[model samples]
Target: MSQGRMASGNDSSVTEFIVLGLTQQPELQLPLFFVFLGIYVVTVVGNIGLLILIGLNSHLHTPMYYFLFNLFFIDDCYSSVITPKMLMSFAKQIISYAEHMAQLYFFSFFVIDECCILTSMAYDRYVAICMPLLYKVTMSKQDCLILLVGAYEMGFVGAMAHTICMLKLIFCDGNIINYYMCDISPLLQLSCTSTYSNELVVFIVVGINVVVPSLTIAISYTLILSDILCIRSTVSRSKAFSTCSSHIIVVSLFFGSSAFMYLKPSPAGSLDQDKVFTVFYTIIGRMMNPFIYSLRNKDVQIALRL
Candidate 1:
């Protein structure tokens, strides 16, 4: 959490990092690898299946489903960044520091894109429920395209900034990442030079990542809730609530695990706990996302049926 132990120069003796996988027990390694392999397989299948379903279904071309498609795509990418290497960590290969930074770069990019996409989804819901008459004008095809582009644009910028900052840090020989992946926290713990500026940048970017979208979602849903409360018929209100329920679950899991993972200080003893929460947002969330949306969405279910 501090600036970290200071080193002499920007040059790093370490060309690569030895990734210590989840457990020390030899008995557990095989089991964990198989478990995560299963998860990664499911993640791939579910996301791809959902993508094909969306592409085939004419009725699924609305703003929310459009965003759901992006969500699934991001989830697929998000899990891909971490899981395959994680499963391979059982065999153990030395990966270059550059590869680690690349991993972090993509991770940051998709996570920010996801947050912004969810924010867009929240806005879509707000329009559908609170500004029904204006919804068409507010969320037209062009508007949806713009929002999606903006999300990726911001993700690119944030990822670039973080990756540049990380590249500046120096690591001595024998750098071993304590956890499964090259997340900001664990990676920062390895820097031989002062990481004050890098940590500050991470703090700022991750703060924006978590806080801004959360506020957008909360505000959107608040207005949505207020409108739903005003509805005269219970059936209408229930139907309205059904549309956003899956998004709510996805938001809660995404932001909750992410906030827990990044917002708090990483104590020395709790790296294992960190690894567990890491699995939640990174690996497990992707595997669950398609199922969550498909099951909760009547349109997607119907599309699958047809």
Candidate 2:
């Protein structure tokens, strides 16, 4: 493979990506596989159930729920990306390298998409809490659709940017990646060529996706806190806090694990540790999405009862 340049000078047709499994321990593989399989099952059911519940219950059709529907969709795609192959690897060792790249492409798409949608959700909450009178006006149905479209666009663009750079990276030597999937960092680490530009782009793109959304969530919650403090009644403050707490938890889990994974100056965080964190963000984090954000809400509870 040419160093940082694709054959025929076109970056799009690069054919394969190597995947490193979760562990090489023969004794541990089957047990770990079963654990992840169970987690994947829970993730699918939880996200699907949340989607159906919100769609069927008319009372849940507000902007909050609308954003949530997108969130569930993202989680569904996220879990689907790596879990099936992971399960298969336990049963059999050799996997298709091209298929692995395809999965990485799709998985990267949803990860970027989810970030944009979550940022929009944070902005929506800000408007609803800070400008309650204009809530419906600001987040109208058309606005929701536009945000959703923008999320998809941003996701594809970001993924394309990363994928293009990845195409330029040479993987001729030591095709074995240290991590379970085709994450940009692990992929870049395997490159025998100069990855300075690739590393910069990865940082910039991942930073934009992770930091922008995290900052939006932070600012929104800050304003929400101010608004809650201004309320005269303890009951109202408690209700407001309760409503916001769940979102805070979900945002923390998603962004926190992501930040931990990418923001480190060193990769001393052991591959095993990275695998654990990836599982948290990719699988366990998703299971917690519905539970932390929408499932426990009193409004959703009441809507479910009705």
Candidate 3:
């Protein structure tokens, strides 16, 4: 296996990276930049506005919106971590190599954090729909706080694991990352050194992060469905189902795209297309969550109106 080392075989040397901006076509640059810039602006304002509105609205102080306010915060974090760097890539195509990895580590951290938060949100829906009377006791303020802490901790620990593993890699071969931001898979491909440990960590961490929550979400909703079917009143059933549907939409989009990009095997064993998939998972998915989960939500709409 090729080992990443300096020209003098010194292990303590820093490497720089060159980012290939979104599109090489000069004609496409400005238009694409403005388009992404607009998306970033909307993402920031919508998420922040939702968080503030939820916080100020006493009516939304309950467990579910508490989960949502946290969700909005995650959206804000997710966008802030990825989009600004993307915008800067437009201004200057190449990024600082070491700095890019550091940024990527943080971005991955938030992405993992969002996964946990979404799962927590799903659990909130499960409780709301299946056990209404017990909802207060089941998802109490303390419970919500603990879950938020767990979400942040999960993100922090997972990110630390991935970043530490990435830093151990040898990247002397080439430093060109095809994606706009530093992602695990893209960074893995750059290693001139063996990636056995890196790949294993990716497998284990991503598997647990993606699969465990996915299964929990499925089970929670399944139990929820069983409960909903027992309700004889059509109007009540319709109302109950509507609220749960938004989360299903958001979860499906976020998790589905993520699974596709990360799990699929390529014949060429390449990640070029994966970079395109990253945009949907990071940028477009972040934007979609607020729209599907909040903007279109009757509760949020009502909250905003008041």
Candidate 1 local Cα displacement, residue 241, angstroms: 0.8
Q: Which 10 residues in a row give candidate 2 its minimum summed lDDT?
A: 3-12
**Tens-digit per-residue lDDT, 94-152, candidate 1:** 67777888999999999999999999999999999999999999999999999999999
Model 2 spans with C-alpha error above 4 angstroms? 1-18, 266-269
Query: In model 1, where do residues sit more than 4 Å from their true spots?
Result: 1-12, 265-269
Candidate 3 lDDT: 0.80
How much is 112 displaced in model 3, in angstroms? 1.2
Q: Which consecutive 10 residues in model 1 have the weakest lDDT in total?
A: 1-10
lDDT tens digits, residue span 1-306, model 2: 632224544332234544558888889988998898898898899899889988998888998889889999899988888788777766654544556556667877898898888888888878977898999999999999999999999889888887877777666555556667767767766666788777677678889999888888898889989998999999988987887787778888888888888777754457778888887898788877877765669987786677
Go through the candidates in order and give each one's C-alpha lDDT: 0.87, 0.79, 0.80
TM-score of each: 0.94, 0.90, 0.93
- The lDDT ranking, best first, is 1, 3, 2
Q: Candidate 2 has what TM-score?
A: 0.90
lDDT of 3 by residue, 104-166 (tens): 778877878878888998899888888888998989999999999998888888888888888
Highest TM-score against the true fold, candidate:
1
Candidate 3, superposed: residue stretches over 4 Å from native: 1-14, 265-270
